[model samples]
Target: MAEHVLEMKNVTMQFGGVVAVNDLSLEVNKGEIVSLIGPNGAGKTTAFNVVTGVYAPTNGAVYFNGKHIVENYPRGKMKKLYAGTSRGVYTKHIEPTPDVITKLGIARTFQNIRLWKSQTVFTNVLIAKHMRRTSNIFTATFRLNRKEEKKQREETEELLKILGLYEVRDELCTSLPYGLQRRLEIARALATNPSLLLLDEPAAGMNPQETAELTDFIRKIRDDFHLTVFMIEHHMDLVMDISDRIYVLNFGALIAQGTPEEIQKNPKVISAYLGEQE
Candidate 1:
């Protein structure tokens, strides 16, 4: 039997009168590379935010690794204005913070590169390891946690070397080339020791060559780290080349999902991107 690493059941996000994600349901199996593709403003990022606990859904629930992580149903004004089904299906309202999600073996990179502007590449990756420290304030403050600190630093160095960033470890993180900066952001996420990795628009703003490099990089990391990858990408070439399966979203709702070949022949997907032919 296949193990599911992430599952979103009937998830919906509504703000005032706008429904950003409607009755979204998806699952990612362990070790599979899944891609979500859509036009701009198709609620792709909203789905990622929901999974990362940035915004709790207005309806339904999200499960990570077979355990329910966040759940909610309409309440008060939301109940009356709710446009989605499954309003009363979930009895409890559960919302976890972003940090809580990160600590739960899930890590992600933003659509835009977010690196520590003033920090060296090594320091940036090292800072991500701080979350895994077992030392309390007193131990950390008094340097009593030197042993643990040293271990973390050693691990960070190893990661940099493995990712080919060791050559510029002492350089400013933001000073690297645009593609390298994106790689550094992913390295920071890896520093968190996550089992599941989510990447948003990883190929954005890249030329053909850099995008191709990223495709290989993503596959390398997934295999090397034993990670399950879920990504939103607009680069159809990358999506078609790399994804084991693909999901299509339009106007905040899923329209199709299948293997790359099936998605390519899907009429609805073609119509969504090209519009209905008269």
Candidate 2:
């Protein structure tokens, strides 16, 4: 059996009185491509946000690699204002920061392209490498650590080449085609050297041909990087073609989960799609 990299147990989130997610539980094993599919307001992105620490779950727990990540930080004004709270009181339970999460082996891309629009393609990726670099900016600015700088540059160039962005490395990100821009975002995420990658709607605006190519590209990257991939995508064909497992969400809850073939035949999925047949 493959090792589980992430686990969510009875996770629920409520915005005031309305529940966004209800007792959601899922797992992604190592080296697997898992796709989360749901209707527009199924709380898919909210689930991602909870897992990535953008929002704390109102109830339940989240575990990554066997460590409990839920409640890593204290909540409420008492904790924030340091009103009689001891320093390091929550230190033992504190989860690592987002940067630490990336460093510890998880990385993600947003639904929208979040690239450095004015920067060169290479620079966009280079910025992600900043997290992994050991040298201080002062040393880099003064050229005091030429070796570390050269190493980082080499790493960036290699990532560009791997993602097929080397030819356009000098171009401004905003000037690239929409497809290339998406690829750049994935490349930037890869630059973090994550063991698990989260991609959000990677084929949102691409033409069919571009989406087809993206399917292959995602597969190749998975194999090459040896990373576990969990994505939320609306493109059914892409999701069915690439994912090893599929999780179906509807109205902020998981309705079905199985192999692609199994999910394709699920009545819940059919109903969720409102009887849209493949």
Candidate 3:
């Protein structure tokens, strides 16, 4: 069986009487493309935030590459707001910082493009590559890491070429069109050398033609990098076209999980998203 690159075990996230994710569980296997889809308030982005370690899950465990990256249980101020059944027991709590999460073979792009607007496209990508550098601060301070820097630059250049961003490598990141900027965010995540890539609304703000290009781009990158991709997207065409499996969410709860054809036929998914009537 293919190894699961990511696993969320009965995870729940809540905030002050508001539950964003409730008893959510899913898995993304190696080399597969999976998607999470729902309406705006279905907690899709919150789930990404929890997985990426932006917010600690109120309960349950998250594993990446077979490592327990984020594990949570109710405590002090959170006991009443855990939104799951883990309360009133011995609960383990461990929430790694976002940067720490990035170094552990998983990387993510935000729903909003988060490039360094003032930095050039090449510089932005190169900065992300620094996360994996081996040189010490002292070595970098004395300009003794020239070889390492050169290699990083070379790799970033090659990545830009592969992602079709080399033509604008010297432009300010904010200067690129919206679609290209989104691609740049994906490239930045790839710079972290991740085995798993998480994309939040990668198709947002894209026209049909641009979305089509992005669909092809995503497929090309997966094949080129041998990556496992999990994304949250509202574009039904894009999600159905590229996903090997999909999970649908409604009001922060999972309504269905299946292949595209099965999900399309699932009455729960159809009723939630398509508003199908008898």
lDDT of 2 by residue, 163-195 (tens): 899999999999999999999999999998998
The residue pairs that clash in candidate 3, if any, are none
Q: Specify the highest-lDDT model's number.
A: 1
> What is each predicted model's overall lDDT from 0 to 1?
0.94, 0.84, 0.91
TM-score order of candidates, top first: 1, 3, 2
Better of 1 and 2 by lDDT: 1
Q: Which ten residues in a row have the lowest lDDT in candidate 3?
A: 81-90
Clash number by candidate, in order: 0, 0, 0
Best by TM-score: 1
Find the 10 residues in a row with the least total lDDT in model 1. 83-92
lDDT of 3 at 124: 97
- On lDDT, the stronger of 1 and 3 is 1
